[model samples]
Target: MTETLARLNATYTEHVIEDFQKKRVPVEIPLCLKEDRIAYGHNLEISYPLKEVLDVSYRYEPGKIGFLYIHTIQGVRTFQINSDPAGFVEQFHQLDHL
Candidate 1:
């Protein structure tokens, strides 16, 4: 098993069935960094390996929430975060040497 290096909260879109209707809702989930991958969701349902990650960045306005972007071979995945992800990005870079 890979050791978890860091943990953060991220917003994810989850589909729900309510009153016989399907709806998309934003849910907060745990995002984790491991030795070789970044995992998302409470159960770690989604993951992107370090080798697949092209870049990671955060964008935000002063006194406002920020967005974390993970560029991977598959595509770019974004997460809404309340604070700067500089440490997370730096840690990932240090681990991946990218």
Candidate 2:
């Protein structure tokens, strides 16, 4: 993550992983939960009863880059990383531009 994104999260509210209107590769941007500075790689998860991860680390590899956020819903948050990071970003942008 860039410093800008980190800063943005700090100065805002809960970042939402929003679904695009055209609905291709969904892209989500996390916002701050409060107007406080959220540090890099800070863990912020929510729970109703059973405590679990609401978001995981966003990984970036030579061929792939992705943010994995897990929820109690289990199957709902399960997916595969079948492409490189550049490819993934391009594909997502293409879907958004469509």
Candidate 3:
């Protein structure tokens, strides 16, 4: 069973789903990093297997913190949230042990 390691409320700012096209949309969803996958969604759900996550990184700007995730199948996606970015890195590092 994959347990939820950390959960954060994030906004999908990179892209969105529109009428028959994948476009960029701004929406808030629950993001979770579990034992075996990273999942995020509200009414819909998307999950990326940990094995396919090639790399994880973070960036700090003047007023915003971002998390960058590179996955094999999902490509590269960035998420900006209001939580501590350092904590996010630490959480993922812990997940690496699992």
Q: Which regions of candidate 2 are displaced past 4 Å? A: 1-28, 31-59, 71-98
Candidates in order: C-alpha RMSD to true structure: 2.2, 14.4, 4.6
lDDT of 3 by residue, 1-98 (tens): 57877777776666767788998877778777788777888842788787887666666554675554534455788777766556555687776632
Residue lDDT tens for model 2, 1-98: 31222211211134445564333343333322222222222444422112322332234454544333224335323223323334333322232221
* Steric clash pairs (candidate 2): 13-31, 13-32, 13-33, 14-32, 15-30, 15-31, 63-84, 63-85, 64-85, 65-85
TM-score of 3: 0.66
Better of 2 and 3 by lDDT: 3
Model 1: per-residue lDDT, tens digit, 29-49? 888888889998779988998
lDDT accuracy of residue 45 in candidate 1: 82
**Which residue runs of candidate 3 sit more than 4 Å off their true CA positions?**
13-25, 65-67, 71-74
For all predicted structures, in order, the TM-scores are 0.80, 0.23, 0.66
The number of the candidate with the highest lDDT is 1
Error of 1 at 75 (Å): 1.7
What is residue 85's positional error in candidate 3, in angstroms?
2.6
Candidate 1, pairs of clashing residues = none
| Maximum-TM-score candidate | 1
Q: Any idea what lDDT model 2 has?
A: 0.30
